[model samples]
Target: MPIQPGETIPSMKLTQGTPDGPRETSIDELFGGKTVVLFGVPGAFTPTCSARHLPGFVEHADALKAKGADVVACMAVNDAFVLDAWAKSQGVGDKIVMLADGAAELTKALGLELDLTARGLGVRCQRFALVAKDRKVAHIGVEAPGAFEVSRAEAVLGAL
Candidate 1:
């Protein structure tokens, strides 16, 4: 089932890379005692993702922070290198936390995995954003296929 508002996130270890090396970050570790804005994209560097989705957040990082987001993070079903590079290219390395769900573990756990074999894109994440406080989801915005309405920074800000 898709995760819903007021539900505690399950304890799942997701891989992310820092300046040092790749490591595991648990759901609790990420959401515990924090107000977080978590957004997922289909893939790194894809047209819609790069042109619209991720950029919206990157452009509004300060606004989001001002609205009580302790951390704004972007996740994709790609490797750490791709995510890191994407963040740097967007000039959002300092603003957004880039997380890699290389094996689609986190995507599947959230029931947001998309099978894009027809597009030759393999497994990807559905576009969505969640406002989380203290490890529980406060609001969830899931976009319809090929739609960029709900998960945009503007939408998330309204939710906040």
Candidate 2:
């Protein structure tokens, strides 16, 4: 089963890009003492991920923050370079934090790993959105494969 409400985010490090290069950060450091909206994508720059999923959060970031979310972040199974490039391509800037779960460790820890080897995508994180308050999950929306209803930004903001 995937991570559920009331459960704390798993303690695993994820990489993020910076001027100095890639920096590894743990879940606690990202979510602890903060109300954060973390959304995961199968891959950065992919169709739905780039076209809709990620953009939704970026568009609604201020609304989410006004609703009490401290940070709005986007996570993917790609490396820091790829994520950083995608963020730039999308003009994300400071609107959202781009997280790189390159090793799938955090996805596996959350029980949300999706096997896409059949499609030549290899292992990936499922499409999902979560509200973590002080490192604990408060709301979660996981979409079925190829679906985008529940994990959209509007739904997550409504939950908040």
Which candidate achieves the best lDDT against the true structure? 2
Q: Model 2, 1-160: lDDT tens per residue?
A: 9999999887778898654568888778889899999999999989999999988998999999999999999888999999988988888988898899988989989988999999999999999999999989999999997899999999998999
Q: How close is candidate 2 to the true structure, as a TM-score?
A: 0.97
Query: What is the number of backbone collisions in each predicted candidate, taken in the order shown?
Result: 0, 0
Superposed model 1: Cα runs more than 4 Å off: none
Off by over 4 Å in 2: none
Per-residue lDDT for 1-160 in model 1, tens only?
6789998777787777565566678778888899999999999999999999889999999999999999999999998878877887788867888889999988988888999989998999999999999979999988888898999999999999
Per-model CA lDDT versus the true structure: 0.88, 0.91
Top TM-score model: 2
